[model samples]
Target: MKNDDYSDVVMAALHVLEESGSLPNIERENKCEKRSDKYREEGNIAFKVGDVNRVLEFYNRALMFAPKNSRAIQLAYSNRSAILFKMGQFRACLIDVETCCKLGCPTDIESKLIKRKNEATVRSEMENLSANLLTGYFKDCFKFDFKSNTPIRCASSDIEVMKGDAFKVVAAKDIKVGTPLALEDSFVSSNSEKNVPFSCHYCHKMSEPDTM
Candidate 1:
């Protein structure tokens, strides 16, 4: 469907949510979560109104404000998958089914019956790429206190370097600790033409200006 048509449905859903005081109640606090539910309801209403595309649009909006709201995502996934399947998009339908399984969305009796009837219809069409074989340039940053002597550690990935506030480069392997880090001769001096005075341990590039 056209973008404008989707936009109109989204606006209507928002209006419904607002009228229902889903976001907030003047008399009460902590009612924002209900906003997402209201949108999901509106999505169902749109579906009944024969606006399949609008139904999808509203469901997506509801999911945005409520990422962990499995029910909303499940309904959207199931309905949209059926719609896509009707449009000859079998691959997309399988994807939705897989997503539903991952989220542990319980299938209703009707849905389970349908699944049993079409047991062999769904097939895995997703490609799995091994992370071990992938390589790419990554930009990351971190904050370090000049006075602190203790090493800072990241839990997810091995940090390549400690650069600045709120960011850090991460790698698959553990970076050798206590390894001698080389600095450009100009880095020690107050006067330097280089944009980045500090050298990165991972790429070994001096690309960012440093305070020290």
Candidate 2:
């Protein structure tokens, strides 16, 4: 219903309950439940249409209006986690997942939420691993010669190529920490998929969605 119609209906119900001497606390709880359900429904509809900002807005409202320790509150957290994960905010997603579990999410959906948590954990770990790899000193394994080849691939004279069980890039010598490694230009280039509108296609820099 439109806001005006919904307000009229709620007012009518409150009038009837007041006539019958319903307790004030009971009326407040009823109103809270109805408002929570309304916002959650709006969030779900926004999610269906991929309106991420609106979805978060409605779900936040749902959480605010939902009673503490209620299933509706848990469901609001659960739904928000889904979008957070999709948006690659793994840490935020994990926080919401834990909140859902602590709130006693419905048994039927508990396993699904756990699975999502595990996936988010893996993604989080992968990101950490990548950061560590980039932050530390990189070994200068080889020095390349500018000789041309038949296939025209970038090759180094210091290293010999051989077929093995698996491909590996091993350091030629043990290096100490805080060492400066050789800097080279990236020979290969690829643009990211347009699925992430908030990040740049070329440099992978993050920007406001409105800028897109």
Candidate 3:
């Protein structure tokens, strides 16, 4: 059957199940389980072939069909987390790992999941630290102090903002251009032009460059 047709059928079935306001039909539940498993298996195949994009796609589809609060859903989330980690998407991977934990990973794989979660968390933290440091450095170059207590207050009243907030630099009193607003220290900083021969390009950390 066409993909659209199959989706319509599934949606209709889900609508019927919802309107019933009772336990899902065992047969229908089992079918969803089977389909989820099939997609997961396909994801495994894609992983073996090193097709990262395909693996992620299959796992996502598996998640869509997997029943809520089911082991299959948790497993799918866990599997997807691994792929996200490989892609260097530590924050996204951490989110998936958290979801797996909330859903209760299978006992046999719980330890493995926990390990992945820890790694993802550490990586996410490190990345965040690096980002903050970079941001601080750039702001400092412009002499902008983000932490300074100014008359301007950042508030959020709109849902359109991603963090559900907006920054409003309102002036309750006269402000000067050279006024020190806030002070922040970068996690790591270096003079690139002076340290190029002895620093890492990415982090600007001092390092020995090969003379080859």
User: Which structure among the candidates has the greatest TM-score?
Assistant: 3
Give a tens-digit lDDT track for model 3, residues 1-212. 74546878888888887888754555633438778999999999999988887887898889889988888898899898888787676777778887888888788888988898899889989999999999999777765434434332332121112222765444445656665544445777667453443356787665421110
Worst 10 residues of 3 by lDDT: 155-164
lDDT winner, 1 or 2? 2
lDDT of 2 by residue, 1-212 (tens): 64545878888998998899883763434438678888999999999998887787787788888888888899988988887788786777788898899888899889989999999999989988987876663433333334432232443232234459976444334645643334356777665543344456767676642222
Please report the TM-score between candidate 1 and the true structure. Answer: 0.35
TM per prediction: 0.35, 0.50, 0.52
The runs of at least 3 residues in candidate 3 whose Cα sits more than 4 Å from the true structure, single-residue gaps closed, are 1-31, 140-212
lDDT value for model 3: 0.72
Candidate 2 has an lDDT of 0.73
